[model samples]
Target chain A: MKKSFHLFYIFIVSISIVVLPSCTKQKGCTDNTATNYDSEAEEDDGSCTYNAETDVEIHFSSMVGTESLVYNQEYTINGRKVKFTRAQFYVSEIHLHQADGDLVHLEDKYLLVHGEEHAYSIGKVASEHYHGISFSVGLDSAANHSDPSTYAADHALSSLDPNYTHWNWNSGYVFIRLEGYVDTTAAANGDADFGFFYHVGFDEFKRDIDLDISQDLVGSTAEIGLEIDFAKFFLGVDMRTENSTHSMDNMMLAEKIADNADDAISAE
Target chain B: MLTMQFQLSKNINRLTNAGVIPAFVSFFLLLSSCGKDELISDTAYNLEIPKGFPAMDIPLDNQLTVQRVALGKKLFFDNILSRDSSVSCASCHLPEYGFSDPEQFSKGVEGRSGFRQSMTLTNVAYNTLFFWDGGATSLELQLLAPIENPGEMDMNMPELIERLSNNHEYPSLFREAYDREIDPFTITRALAAYERTLISGNSRYDKYMYHEKNDALTESEKRGLEVFNSSRTNCSQCHSGFNFTSFGFENNGLYEYFADSGRARVTTLHSDVGLFKIPTLRNIGVTAPYMHDGSLTTLEQVIEHYQAGGKLHENKSPLITGFQLTTQEKTDLLNFLNSLTDYEFISQTAE
Candidate 1:
């Protein structure tokens, strides 16, 4: 009977060694900071989920005076009626001023904003409050002269669709493309038959726009609203006489438009 | 040891039951087949550097390789680069005509004429800047312009990539040459690699000047060389050096009102208004219709234009002060220019 009892004890011990671990040690995400953290877990499963970093979405809207600007829509500017067929520009080298006085520079980032598209995510950043924002209207010299084909398909600098922003002959990106028809008639009553293109580009014509505004990005996402006023964009210029400028073709007009960009764009 | 054997047999039985064993064997066979298919032979290509010419400055990333040159030569002659596949680089730059088109302005897809004449690719590896306006900084970058220009190939980079990637033969060829898939980087580098091999320093002039061959040039041709180097003619002032071009942008007074605006289109400076990049005079006999506009049809017209001091323009080169040449001197100058043609360079078949 003692020998039988010893055998039973050995079997019990072997069973316990095999089965105790399965019952006692729970395998799950061991990180307490993770969203799916299991408090009862004693072993890590290498599966953990964490909160995403704060992302900033910059929204751009085109405006002609009071109403929102629409493509193929006519608007009166400088006492002349104009209708925009295409409106696009590149915004590059965005910088956000944090509340702690540290500037967050978004390196090698570019956004090819069009009249149709509204919002673009500038990617994730540290969660904090920002005081001001600064960005360039065009690409820097290095980015401007880089081979567009090297970029990914979805990249702003890629030579994909909506590629009219690049000047193939000149080997540079057109900073701002504002093409439309304007009424150049003497009485200003005729149809807007005159087509004008303001393709501002080249390194010298790149303009920097800085604005002081309050933005809190302490959450998962934050938004910044900006508007480009066409009425103010055509400020200090007579569209009837100055109907066209391909940057190098008419430097004076391109410079006027580039200089006027600071006042033309503002925080909404 | 018995337990280990049992465990091993059990694992093998499980694998066999799950059909993993056959799958593993087939996967290895597939991998071996792929290896055989992409057997890339990377043989180094020795570019024959012509005598009297400096060693070619090849990009570090794109060294000369036999497979790369062969692939580039095929691409050069292929018409698949265009939008409609109607024209190729060779269409505008024919190898027989010193890699230049006979037309005043080379036509593109659908017969669309370009603004400037197609420049010769003879010794194009020596060029510092590309295009009439010096728009492109490198030969690799220069190919992008012609490919994307609406008046040229009329094709974008993304589309070209798609087309090349879809081709059955190009992918393997590209893999063998560049060890990468077909992309802009490989395409541009390969084309440039072949063009850099177009060495043109085997002319009669080279024999006479560098090889010390006394009977290489005639007495009349010798006199023409004197006139060319003479300070009175100033021919060699802008068109200097072994390649016959200083590679500088100068307003040659081609126009008074400045229709095209030449180099100013790039620099945006008023002083650079009518300036265009000086072209190489090598193989001038075959690459005809001279000047950026291709307005002058013959060498005599070009010489006459220089003799007449070019058209009047404020930004004209100060060196454009005209010179006088006798009829015999004109023939000798013409003969000397013809001697620059390298029959071996142009007529040689692809290796």
Candidate 2:
């Protein structure tokens, strides 16, 4: 009877050791919304993985009045003929306003719009009825002053060949670059001979662009169309006297251009 | 059950007594100790801090390491950081010239002139603000300016990283130093680590002041020191402390019509216009053509500018109310400035 009791005690001890470890609970992704969520997981291990799909696509169209903006193509602005050789600007801090009043913030996302590049895919977001979209025309102070070399070569703020947006000497990013030829002559009859450049950047000059539009990402990708009119960018500036500003050199002109840039953007 | 447990314990005790289990445990401990010793030896780097100077505040993430300093020194002298491979940091900041260019404006890639004179790197580790306008807040950030400046290296940071990664030796060097691939974080940290090691404190002035060696300075130098500390000259007011700099931004009246707008470029304040960071007087003898613009060719000119109360700028320091110095006093003051040169620092090679 004693031998049988001892055997029973040993069996219980062995079973308890095996079962206790299992009862401690395994760690894994516990969030149901995550693509790699484990239903059996009792504790969240912060290993949640989500789908990297393009749920929202933002398209930009650069224009001068009713005409599509073409490089080196002459366009009339404020009764003067102007031709843009280059036009580029940065967009950052994108947030999508849902119909239910929840904001889907796309953290650390930056886009550099230049030339024929028009479409950008802001990766996977929760399926909802988005009512409006808001973004900054330039990088925030923290992003502007951050080391450009830290980013990957393919990133918008990379300081790579295609995106030489940083001012190394002054230590900040050039948010907007608009360079071209303008007819600064008194008669305004000759060809666009005067070279003009407005390289706008600074923490004070970052403009917020908000567009109220309906975009539903419930079934398919939500497409947001935006148009930027270049003519409206030169509303109050006289090319003859004010044709150049490197942002820091001419604060008044840079401020004027920044304000105009804000008014120029509209939701399509 | 009690008898069975006692028998099991006896068997374990026998194994321990027989030295089988004990030997295994001893071997494991020995292996771990050896690993720890090797790690300490490999990564430990002793920075020679000169006497009287306070211990430098090193970043926790980037502790001093021999491999990292070696990598930084190599990069500092390498022209590969430039766009055309025409210039290195040592090109403008020559070691012989006290890490300052003799030219008023240091030449960069394709011999393009920079706006301001190259500041001395001697004792730069102690500095909180960098550049004449104090644009950069840290040494790591300051390094990026020269590399990307169109007048300087003109090298795109991404391209430079790619180049370094592809190089035959840099990948291994970087791996050994940082235990990671060549990136901006490691590059900047390593460079800063090496720069911090450039300590210059064993000058004649240091011996006279810190060491209590009365004879270290000559009679003229001693009199010059008295003048420097005297309220009449007020030279020590801004150029105060052991490093001989308060590091405050002041318009020493270098110019009335400010071209660069000095600290105003960073602060955008009217009062900050024409104000530049006060440079250290250490190694001032060798680092000639002084001031932010390198307009003062000699120490005599600098003293004279101060004596004349500087060119009448609205934002000039009130301490610069002109003071007269006799001819003999001027010579003594000049001699005293020469005493700050650290010959041992400039000639020493990396161990």
| Tens digit of per-residue lDDT, candidate 1, span A1-268 | 7676545444443443343333334568998768899887776879887765588899888788887889878889888889988878889999999888888888777999877788988987777778988999998999998877667667898776464477766788999888899999988887787998899999998999999879788687888899888767689889989989988888999999889889988998
Model 1 Cα lDDT, one tens digit per residue, B114-184: 97889989899888788899988778878888888888899877788899989988999998898888877
Per-residue accuracy of model 2 over A1-268 as CA lDDT, tens digit each: 7676545445444443343343334678998879999998877889998754347778888898999999899998888899998888888999989888888889888989875577888766777667889999899999998877667757788766475777765678888888899998888887887999998998999999888988667655767889988777788999878999987678889899889877888898
B79-123 per-residue lDDT for model 2 (tens digits): 999999999888888776778888999999999998898999988
Worst 10 residues of 1 chain B by lDDT: B1-10
How many clashes in each structure?
0, 0
TM-score of chain A of each: 0.80, 0.82
Model 2 chain A is weakest, by summed lDDT over 10 consecutive residues, at A15-24
- Model 1 error, position B278 (Å): 1.1
- What TM-score, to 2 decimals, does candidate 2 have? 0.85
Cα distance off (Å), candidate 1, residue B199: 2.4
DockQ of each: 0.19, 0.16
Candidate 2 stretches greater than 4 Å from native: A1-26, A30-54, B1-42, B348-351
